[model samples]
Target: MELISSAERNRLFESFKQDAFHLELRDDYSVPDEESPFTSWTRGESVDYSFMESWTQLIRSATSEGKTVRRVRVITEPHTPYIQWEHETTGINDEAGEDIRWLPRHRLPEGITFPMQGNDWWLYDDKLLAVGHFDDEGRVLGSEVITAPDVVAECVRVRDLLWGLAIPHGEYQP
Candidate 1:
């Protein structure tokens, strides 16, 4: 399990031939960069989105190239503070050309299972898998790159199933 750096991940995104899909199963993410912004949002203070400009640009460039970028987040209802913050700000990703969807955890279809220990992942072109590793507190540790056929196959199954059941961000109130 080789851990891929952020730069490598960006390169993969730039080089993907068709589509990039992400599956987020966690309800709370403890990204350090989001701490201050999350705190401000909790306080009802105006939050700055300038920090996301680069990422948004990346997505915009990808979509403009006719490559698709999509993600589905599985969240618990009555949302956690982090989930609430994510829900409130998903427009940033949408405006950048990414398709985002929300699925309530309880609504997942019965007997369906996820691959890669149920961790979050970015599947590029249905070939490469970048599985996210998080610390006990939910902070990012690093992403592990996997290229095994069986594993990628299972992830594809998970993506297809959950994506079909997820609601578009605009219609999801959570």
Candidate 2:
């Protein structure tokens, strides 16, 4: 249960050699930086994406080094505004070399199970799991890094199962 800062997580992204897989289960994220953009998007105003430069660059660098960067977002249909915003802005991630996929929560396969963490996580090279922690308001607190074999195996299993059922960003309408 070692909590890590964003900079430390970025270091993991920069160092992973094989693959980086993110599982996003939350329907809304109350990130302070996204408040303005989300408001603008809801108002039908053009939203600025400059804030994503650093992340996009990191993904690009990872993919350029022959590592795969991918994510599977489990969203509810008739999405929350935040999820819609994320879906709309996914192109930035795609252009930056990430493979994004969507899975409607209801479409989840029967009998599927999640790890005990039951939170969003970034699994690096199928070995390290950086589990995201959020406050009740959906604000990110920090990530906990776990390397235990059983936990890591569970996360890997969840990632693969959901990833296989998710629709590619380009193909998913919502």
Candidate 3:
């Protein structure tokens, strides 16, 4: 199980030919880069969004090329503070041309199971996956790249199913 840093995983965007889809299963993400801004947001202070520039820029470039970037967040009802912060900031992602949706955990299809041990994953062109791993503190460790056809197929199936049930960010209220 080789792990690649998030930066390296992001590089997959440079070569993916069509769509990149992300399945987010966590209610809280203790991302170091987001700590300061998230803290400010939690404190009811203005958050400078400059920290997101690199990522948004990447999304913009990809979408401008006619490539699609999408995400489905599987969340819990009565959102966590981190999720609320994410919801508030998601418009920036939308503005950059990514399509993000929200699906409450309770809404998941009955008997449905997540592959890759329920880790969050980014699937590129429905062929490769970057499965996220986390530390005990819930901080991102890195992502493991997986290309087994069987695994990718399972993730693709899950993506299609969940995407259909998720509400677009613009339409979702908490």
Candidate 4:
């Protein structure tokens, strides 16, 4: 399957008419751009977050146009260092107009199964999906664009369920 670069995937935001939803299923991600910042954070050192400006800008621009951006992160309790950091920093995303929620894995509905073989995905306007693929070391490889109705439908269903169940960023503690 052909994959698109993250930049290309982000471009989808420009054309999508309404909403963009992201489902995050990982406890840790090894994004290259975040390596130094994450290392610094882990070391208890103050670190610059300029690396996140580009993404926040994207969300800001899109949401300013009245488009909705949302995310539901499924995580385990006793968060990993990466997740702890992500939790601490989620306010930035929220401030940019992205509605982010957290759902502990244990709280997932019984018998529910994720589509796209359980990988993370971004759903745009409930019609298109950009499924994230990661290398063995957990670095993102890019995304595979899928417009198949069945797949998108299942994702929409999952999104609806999880979104309803997740706790909004400000309300969740740890």
What local lDDT does model 3 show for residue 91?
Answer: 97
lDDT for model 3, on a 0 to 1 scale?
0.96
Q: Which stretches in model 4 have alpha-carbon errors above 4 Å?
A: none
Model 2, residue 154: what's the lDDT? 87
For all candidates in order, the CA lDDT equals 0.90, 0.90, 0.96, 0.96
Q: Worst lDDT window (10 residues) for model 1?
A: 1-10
For 40-99, candidate 2 gives per-residue lDDT tens digits of 999999988888998999998999989999999999999998898899899999999999
lDDT of 4 at 68: 97
RMSD to true structure for each model, in Å: 1.0, 1.0, 0.5, 0.6
The TM-score values for the models, in the order shown, are: 0.96, 0.96, 0.99, 0.99
How well does model 2 score by local distance difference test?
Answer: 0.90
Q: Cα deviation of 116 in candidate 2 (Å)?
A: 3.4
Which ranges of candidate 2 are over 4 A from the true structure?
Answer: none
The alpha-carbon deviation from the true structure for residue 114 of candidate 1, after best TM-score superposition, in angstroms, is 1.4
